[model samples]
Target: MKIRTRLSLLFTLITAIILLLFATAIYYSAAKDREKEFYSLLKKEAYTKANLFFDADITQKTLQDIYKNNRKILNEVEVAIYDTRSNLLYHDAVDIDMVKETPEMLQSIHEKGEISFYQGDWQVIGVRYPFQNEYYLITATAYDEYGYTKLNNLLNSSILIFILAILVIFFTGIYFSKKTFDPVRDMIKKAKIISASRLDLRLPLKDNKDELAELTNTFNEMLTRLENSFEAQKLFVSNTSHELRTPLTRLLTELELSEKKQLTNDEYASLIHNLTTDVQQLIRLSNSLLDLARANYDRSKITFKTVRIDEILLDARHQVQKLNPQYKVNICFDMETEDDSDISIEGNEYLLQVAFANLFENGCKFSDNLQSQVVITNKEKKIQLTFSDSGIGISEKDLKKIFDPFFRGDNKYFTEGNGIGLSLTKKIIEIHNGSITAQSELNHGTTFIIELPI
Candidate 1:
């Protein structure tokens, strides 16, 4: 069942139970009070009869006539009196023998002073009556016909009210439940029309400062993130396709030309060398593309361990120096801490090394003197590494997009690169939960700063 239906049924069931308990309590109290009142009236009638017969010197026939004339018609009261010897002295009913007063019954009334109990539909009250130094027992019984009729009517009315209350509670519960979940229904309807092409569509917020509004805002944020990711993926694919097509097209054209003619030895050797250069460029581009992809892939694929950022920088420096011996790469630790672990951070060692290598190579490649300076500082739970060089610094417009895939500054047109190094480096740093930033001015120098938590 739906939650709304369940809630409605539960509400109705609980209301019914409460109404039943209330009706039962009211009916019981009314019945008890009516019985007490009837018993009081019956006791008064018994006392009046005793006074008339014994104290007033009135005959039993005249007293019976007065009782029959003055008694309430609905209060079918009957009275009996007995002496201490259990001999009946007075009775006003034809069935007085049916209500036998045993010696135990009279002794009970004498001992307790007064007693009352139910005898089928009749309520009986017995009392000790003493007159002229003689002990007597008086018993009265009556049926509350009017009170019972009121009780039956109350019972029928209560049942009707209970049923009506249950129905009201059920429908009210359903109406409120639907009204409460109306936002969810609207969200579902809006979400159905949204596809990848319609990512710009956003769910409306109620601004009610409630959970439903919170849910709507959260879904809108998720859609925004998904849209950004989709756009980035599209851009990455487009750039990769363009970068790969250039080299592939060259390779195919050169191979087709070579197959069309047989040439002299020198010409053939030159053609082979040119083709080899293009093939090497393709290889480099392919490797760079793979690195970019690996850097941006799911972080779960990368293994993590505690690694010293200083040591990783040293390793990257050595690798860069080996690849370009003419370029100068220097490193230093610029912190007061003697503990080596202070400079340590958790990350994939190889990926960190690759990121630092790209930054170092970029510094060396762009500098006029092919020289770069490296500084490392360790602080509380963080390490700051800076790479500075006297290079052809980036322009303001190009610097903003320097880390974008396949983006190269205008001044670096002659540089031999696929332009994915900085992009891959950025992705790797981000994957390690670190940040990289750059400060540069055209023709002055460039500096790359990296921050990582230990």
Candidate 2:
């Protein structure tokens, strides 16, 4: 069953039980009051009969006539009188088979003064009356027909009221349940219209600061992240295709030219050398692309530990020099503290090395096979590394796009790179909660600065 239906039914059931209890209490109280009133009337009649029977001047016929005239009657009323020896003295003018009083009951009434109880459907009351200095027993019995009818009517009315109350409670529960879940329904409806092509769409949020509003806010954040990821994937695919197409096109053109004409041994050798260069260039581009992809992995999935920043720098400088033996990378440390423990940070060692290696390679590559200087400084739990290169530097406009994938500067047309190294380095730094910035003057020099928290 739906939650609304279940809630409604539960509400109705609970209300019905309470109503039943209330009705029962009311009905029982009314019945008790009716019984009390009937007993009072029977006792009144018995008293009147006792007064007339004890009057010395009244004859038996006169007593009966006075009793017939002065006594107020009730339905199914019956009265009996007994002498001190338990002999029958007076009987009421009742046509029904009256309930008999036992000697044991009269003995109890004599001792207790008065007693009332039920004899089957008849209500019986026994009283001790003193007349002429002798004790007499007066007993009355009756079935309260009017009170029974009233009780029956009350029971029927209570059942009707109980049913009506349950119906009201059930519908009220349903109405409120629908109102409570209306926001969820709206969210589902709006979510159905949202797709990849419509990622800019957002769910409506109320200012009520309730749970539903919180859910809507969370969904909107998720949509924003998905849109950013989609845009990044599109840019990556476009740049990779463009960068791969260039080297492949060059190789195909050179091969086609050689096939169309015969050439001398030196010309053939030159063509072969050019072909080998193109292949090697393609290999370098592929490796750089792979590194860029690997850098995008979530940092949580990679192994992390405390590592010394100075060791990473030394290792990166060694690797860069190994690749390009003629390039000089000078490292210098500038610290105010003698303790090297302050220079340690938590990170994946391999990825941190890759970021530093990219920066060193960029400095050496841009400085025209000349020397590059790397200076490290420590300040307030942070490490700052600066790479200074003296070569053809970047233009002011191209500097802004330098960290973008496949974005080479306008002044570095002859540089041997696919321009993915700096972007990959920037991504790695960001994942480690660090920052990288650059300052350059065309044909003068370029310097890259990196700051990492220790």
Residue 169, candidate 2: C-alpha displacement in angstroms = 4.1
Q: Write the per-residue lDDT of candidate 2 for residues 1-454, one digit (tens) a residue.
A: 9877898898889888888898999999998998899889889877876786776556666655554554456464567788767787876553443667678888888899999999887788888999868999999887887889999999999889888888888888899988987888898899999998998888998897988888899999999999888877888899889888988999999999999999899999999999998998899889888888888888787777899988998898898888788878888987656676778888878888888888787777777767888888986678888888888888899999999887887755657788788899999889889999999998888999988898
Per-residue alpha-carbon lDDT of model 1 for 1-454, expressed as tens digits? 9877888788788878888899899989988888778888878977877776678987777766655665555454677888877778888754444356788998898889899888887778898888888778888877778878988998899889888888888899899999988888999999999999999999998769999899899999999999998988898789888877887888798789889998889978988898887888888788788888788778998889999787888899899898789989889778877787888888999888888888888888888889888899875577888889988898999889989888877865747777899889999989988888999998998998888888
Cα-based lDDT at residue 180, candidate 2:
83
What's the lDDT of the predicted structure labeled candidate 1? 0.84
lDDT of each: 0.84, 0.84
The parts of candidate 1 lying over 4 Å away from their true place are 1-58, 61-72, 82-88, 94-105, 129-136, 176-182, 263-303, 319-327
Global Cα RMSD, each model? 3.6, 6.1
Total backbone clashes of candidate 1, pairs 3 or more residues apart or in separate chains:
0
